[model samples]
Target: MPPVPTDATTSTLANSPAASLATSQGSRLAQRLQDLGPLLGLILLCIAGWVLNPDFATAANVLNVLTRTAFIGIIAVGMTFVIIAGGIDLSVGSMAALIAGAMILLMNAIGTAIESAYLVVTLGIVFALLLGALFGLAHGLLITKGRIEPFIVTLGTLGIFRAYLTYFANGGAITLDNAVSDVYSPVYYGSLLGLPIPIWVFLLTALIGGLVLNRTRYGRYVQAIGSNEQVARYAAVEVDRIKMLTYVVLGICVGIATVLYVPRLGSASPTTGLLWELEAIASVIVGGTALKGGEGRISGTVIGAILLSVISNILNLTSIISVYLNAAVQGIVIIIVAFLQRSRR
Candidate 1:
């Protein structure tokens, strides 16, 4: 018989190069699985959807689902940057409502001064983008300059934004001018190469967002800051500025999504964009982004957004559960994903 191994021999084996290599390989494999998790989930969900309702696979149904997804998908792209940079913004839904209300009011007011519906629409779009940037800048300044926590800041603004919109509307809906609505409807309803304009916009936004996150210096800085803010600063990164820009990017995305959304409903109310913050945040986490920040991918976010939309579509098509419980499902997804993140850690 071979000599019984001693404690020292066992310890030596554990510390050997082969053991290290094995550990490294295991880690890499786990990481790849985590990265593919969202995509795989999406495929499985689609299969289930098809099985539940053969109508789910039709071209019209698929396009309709995607068109509906554009608003949240666009916003989720920006949320990806914010989460990767170790920040959160709960005010996005309320911000969109306020922006939509303001856009309608502005367009209505301007229609009287300008006979050109196109010119009025152009002004409304510009106003929406500028206002979004301004709001984002305010959030950044308060967080960076005022040295406040992002959660607290955005939470306060969430209430404030919605309250302002409510007050402006006098607790009612703000409807778009009919003529302007007709002109702007195409932004949401029109199709290009057999795809909805909103879908096209979503694709373009994702493409640009992916490029910015993967191929640019700013993206690296955002990741470094999220990984370790103090270490990033020590490494000569402008941590505050990068963090600020991430919020600005998110705000711009909110603006773009709102521009697309307003035309669909032709109105903004207290109910407008309800629980969108939940959906947006859920999408980012589901896409494999770390809740604690430091690591993420835009592609994952895009898939996550699509996956959530698909889930909602499936539910609607199959009545697997009440349509009213859609938000509940998303909340559950966030909780599950968060738990998984903690377990992985």
Candidate 2:
């Protein structure tokens, strides 16, 4: 978190008639172009994939790409809020693993303890979401009330969560109970109205996120808080409260992603959600949200997530680069997009 200026500093800046404007001049055309950045990137990636390998554009491959996109895409939605509100969460990936592992362990115990209970799976899902929210709340409180930097706070929690997961899994995999596996598998692989469930979940999350960010007073507060903390304080915005809620929202999103994630693998491994924070951040940045905060486009974030999946999918289908090089490509792409975003500003 940046330093919150004092009243004197605020008054000094305000009274300076010669103070130069540092903010973007409101321009609808420029804002539209910025909003289109991720979509344009997605289009270019698709075109490249098609030109490189015709199979990349096939329906089956596209569906596969979307399936892969669902996990990170969902997480990125929450990340948009955190970043737009001027915060970061490094613990999300580890937090997801921790939440998923706990939920699985609970469900398995429930299955063994109560053979007749079919609601265990549902209970586990709720439990995971609740756990995620709690984790977020903890992070939020420590950062807001404690006045700790988000990067430092979330980084510490990231390691703590990862360590707990490792201990919970005994440094191995935590498999879902056989009895519950059959019952829970459909949540990940099953489809509704000819669409995979994860896709539907991502779409719903993005829709709600978009509405909250674009249409609500809370959303405006978020932007204000992120753009300029001092100004936000002067305007009577509850900076800490809004910032704390962003993390809570992020936690819920991670929990939802993990719920869908667990059924697909039928197990929780320590490796699950590794480095997901970096990917989610990349998606949000590519989506046109400034690293300095105060702006976001939910639709662009979704497109950015899909763009990442497409890039990976394309790399997997070709020999142009080794599989190990995929991460390198992603890093380079993120850097390039960041530069583009900076140039636009």
- Local accuracy of candidate 1 as per-residue lDDT tens digits, 1-345: 224443243223334232243246556676667678777777877888999999999999999989988999999999999998889999999999999999999999999899999999999999998888888889998999899999999999999999999999999999998999999999999999999999999999999998887667687677767767776787777888999999899999999999999999899999999989988888888887877786688888888888888877887888777878877975675455444433155
Candidate 1 — which residues are off by over 4 angstroms?
A: 1-25, 320-343
Mark the 10 consecutive residues where model 2 has the least summed lDDT.
Answer: 15-24
lDDT top scorer: 1
* Residue pairs clashing, model 1: none
> How many collisions per candidate?
0, 0
lDDT of 2 by residue, 1-345 (tens): 224443234333333221122232555456566567667777877898899899988877887788778889999999999998889999889999999899999998888877654688889999999999999999999999999999999999999998998999999999997779888988888988878888899999999999888667677677767767787877777889999999999999999999999999888888999989988888887887777776677888898888778878888888888777888987777666555555244
lDDT of 1: 0.85
Worst 10 residues of 1 by lDDT: 10-19
